[model samples]
Target: MYKVKVFVTLRESVIDPQGTVAKDSLHKLNYGEVSDVRIGKYIELTLEKTDRNIDEIVKEMCEKLLVNLNVEDYRFEIEEVVAQ
Candidate 1:
C-alpha cells in the first residue's frame, strides 16, 4: 500500500479571497500579529500497490482531477505503508 499526501494552493499571481477574509477576521479578533494568510487544500489518498511508477500515477491524478493547473499548484509526497 501507499499513502499520498497532496497539497493544492492558488498560484502566487492569483488572489485568494477566502484567505483575505480570514486574515481580516483575525485582525478584528485581536490577532494583529498575523501578517498574511493563504488558504489551500490538503488531500490524502491510499492506493494499492501497482506495477506502474508511483510518480507517474500521482502526476496523472493531479493533472486530470486533483489540481487545476491553470490557477492552482500542487505538491505531493508518497510513502510506502508496511503491512502489519
Candidate 2:
C-alpha cells in the first residue's frame, strides 16, 4: 500500500469569502497582523494496489476527483510503503 496526501486550495487570484470572514474575526480579536486566512481541505488516501507509474495515476485521480479544476489548485505527494 502507498500513502497519498492531497492539498486542495484556492487559486491565487481567486477570492475566498471564508478567508475574509476568518480575517475579520482575527482582527476583532486583536490579531490584525493576520491579514489573510485561507481555508482548504486535506485528504489522505491509501492505495492498496501499486504499479510502475503509481504516482502519475494517483495524481490524475486527485485532479479528476479530489480537486475542482476551475477555481481550485491541488498538489499531492505519494510515499512508497515498505512492508515491515
Which candidate number would show the highest lDDT if scored against the true structure? 1
* TM-score of each model, in listed order: 0.97, 0.89
Flag clash pairs in model 2. none
- Each model's lDDT comes to 0.97, 0.87
Which segments of model 2 are wrong by more than 4 Å? none
Give per-residue CA lDDT, model 2, range 1-84, as digits (tens).
888888899998999999999999999999979969999999998888655688788778877788888999988888878779
Candidate 1 residue-wise lDDT, 1-84, digit = tens: 999999999999999999999999999999999999999999999999999999899999999998999999999999999999
Decoy 2 TM-score against native? 0.89
What's the CA RMSD for each of the models?
A: 0.5, 1.3
